[model samples]
Target: MSGNGERVVFVLDAPGDESLHTGGTIARLLDDGADVTVLFGSATSYDSDASAPTTASAGAADVAAARAALGETDPAQWRVLAGEPQGAQRRAVLGEAFAQAHATAVVAAAVDPALRQAAVDAAGEQGVPVFLSSRVSAVPGVRLTAIDVSDHIDKKLAALAAYPGRWRLDGRVVRLIDGTEALVTGTETYASGSGPAQPAELEAPTVGSRLLAVLMALFAGALFGVLGTVAHQTTIELGSLTIPVGLTLALLASGTLLLGLRLVVHDRLVVLAAAIGLVATVFLLSLRSTGGSVLVPAGVPGTVWSMAPALFAALVIAWPRIPARRPTA
Candidate 1:
C-alpha cells in the first residue's frame, strides 16, 4: 500500500534561484506517484521571449507562465501557481492554489525564510502537510527524517514519506529514525485546540469535620438518653388521671423514630424529622418532671443540636459528586 490517500508535492523556486532543487524534488515526487506542481520564478529563461519588466507587465507575465506550465494537466494530479512579493497577497494566492490543486503535501526550498514561513502558514490554513529541506548532506542509503515540532499535517506527511518504516507520528509530533536507530527531529509549526478537563477524585473526610460530626451526633443522642431516663423516673397527673408509663413510652418512641429517620434519610429531610422527634421527647420528659404541666416548653433547640452530625456527614458525602456546569453545545 502507498499509505493513506493521494499525495501532491508543491515545489516553489527559492530566493537564490534554487530551481534545480525544486525540480529535483518535483521529479522525486512524480516518481513516487505524487502529483507535482513546479512554481518557478519568471526571471528564469525557460521561455525567453515571454515579456519585459514593468510591475504590471511582470505580474501578468508571471501569471501567464504559471498558467502555461499547468495547462493540459489532469486536475487530479498537478497544478502550478506563482508567488507575489507581498506576504498577504502571496498567502491568499497560495491558499487558493492549494485548495484548487487539492494538495496533500508540500516540499519547498528552506533557503528563503520569508517564503518558507508563508508556505508553512498557507499549508496550515489549508490543512496540508509540509516538508522543509535541511542543509545537512544525505548519506547513501540512509533515510531522511522530518521532525514535527508543531504537529502540522504537512510535516507529518513528509516525515512519513521520507522515513517510511522508521517513523512514528504522534499527535502533532513525528519521530524519525535511521536503520541504526539514530534520529534527527524536525519541529512542526501548527496548533491544535485544547482537550477537555478530567474529573477529580474524592478525598477522605478531614479530621476536624469528622470530629465535629461525631460530637454533634453524640450530643443529640445524649439528650434523648437523658430524657428517657427522666421520664422513667418521674410521674405526672392530668384532670384527676395519672399518666406515668404512657408518657414515658411516648417520649422514647418519638426519640427512636427521629433517630431512625436521621440515619436512613438524606440530610435535607433529616433536620425536619430530628426537630419533631426532639420536641416530643423534650415535652414528654418535661411533663414527668413538672407534674403534667406545660410550664416548661418542648426543647425545640435540642433538635437542631442533635441533627448537626447527620447534616455534616451528608454534606461530606454529597460534595464530591456535585454536578458540574456544562458548556453550551
Candidate 2:
C-alpha cells in the first residue's frame, strides 16, 4: 500500500509462529514484486525454546537476507510484525496496517470464521481482496485460487533457510507439499470487495464443521434409503436380467437424494457427504429388506435392485465437486 502503487500483501493467522507452511507462497509473492508483510507471534510455539529466533524476528531477518541474496535491498518493500492477535484485535491491527500500507490482498491460513470474517470486513472497508488458505479436502466449494507452487520451490526453500534452528527445508517436506495441493477459498461476497460476506457463507471447514456435514449426510442417507426401499419392490423384472429397471430406479434414487440434500444443505461438500450416507444406508436397508430370501424366480434381479440405489447415490454426490484431474504425459 505505497503511494507508488505497489501491491501490498498481508500473510496472517499462521499457527505456532512458523512460516514453514506458507514460506514459499510468501516468497513467490515477493518475487512477483508485491510488498509482502508477514505477521506472526513470538511466544506461540512450544517448540521454540529460549535460544531460538521467533518467526517474527526470522521473518524480518529472512526477508532482508533473501533480498540481499537476490541483489535487492529496499527497506520499504517489506516489513514483518510480531505479536499480532486474531479476532477483533487482529481486525483493528490488520485494518490499521492495511490502511497504512494500503494493502491490496490478505492471505490468511488456519484462521477461524470469526477472525476471517473480521479480516474480510476490514478488507471490504477498504475495497481490498482477501484469500483464505486451506490444506483440507473436507469442504472446498468456495475455493478461489489454486495455483501450483512447484515452480517457486527454490525461492521458497531459500526463504525457509532463514530460520536455521528448526526450518531447514527437507526433501520429504518439499515432496509432501508438492504432492498435496493447497486450496484457497472465499465466499461470493469476497468477490464484492466493498461488501461484507456472511459468516455462514464462509464455513471455516474445521473438524466440527466437517463432522456436522457428516451428520447431515447421515440424515440424508436415511431419507434416501427409506424412499428407495419402497420403490425397489415395484421394479418389473425383464427375463433373466433386471439391470434396466434396477438401474433406472437407482438413477431416480440418486436424483432424489441430490434434491433432498439441496433443500437442506448449503455447502456442496455437505451435500456430497449426505449422498454418501444415503448410499450406505440404502445398502444396509436393502440387506435387511431382503431378509435372506431369494426373489421368486429372478434372484439376479433382486441383487441388481439391492445394489442400484447405493451406486446411483455415489454417482450423483461425486459429480459436482470432482477434484482437478492430474495431467498425464
The numbered model that scores best in lDDT is 2
Candidate 1 per-residue C-alpha lDDT over 1-329 given as tens digits, one digit per residue, 9 for 90 to 100:
03235455454432112221232333333334555654432332221123222221123333333223323134433223443444677767766776776877765443344455566677777767665554311223222343222222332234233322333545434443322222323331111111112111123456776556555544564465445534543456788986567345635554554445454432423434344345444444445344554433445433432343345334433443233232111
TM-score of each: 0.31, 0.45
lDDT of 2 by residue, 1-329 (tens): 12134554544433222244554455445566656665542233222123323343344465566544332356654443436465567677667777877676765442334444666677777777666554311233453434444555665555445555443345425322214322221111112123275421344568897788778676866776666555555556678854446446755766776766654454567766766666666556655334675222246545665666556556555556444332211
Q: After superposition, how far is residue 246 of candidate 2 from its true place, in Å?
A: 35
What is the lDDT for 188 in model 2? 12
lDDT of 2: 0.51
Using TM-score as the measure, the top candidate is 2
> What's the TM for model 1?
0.31
TM-score of 2: 0.45
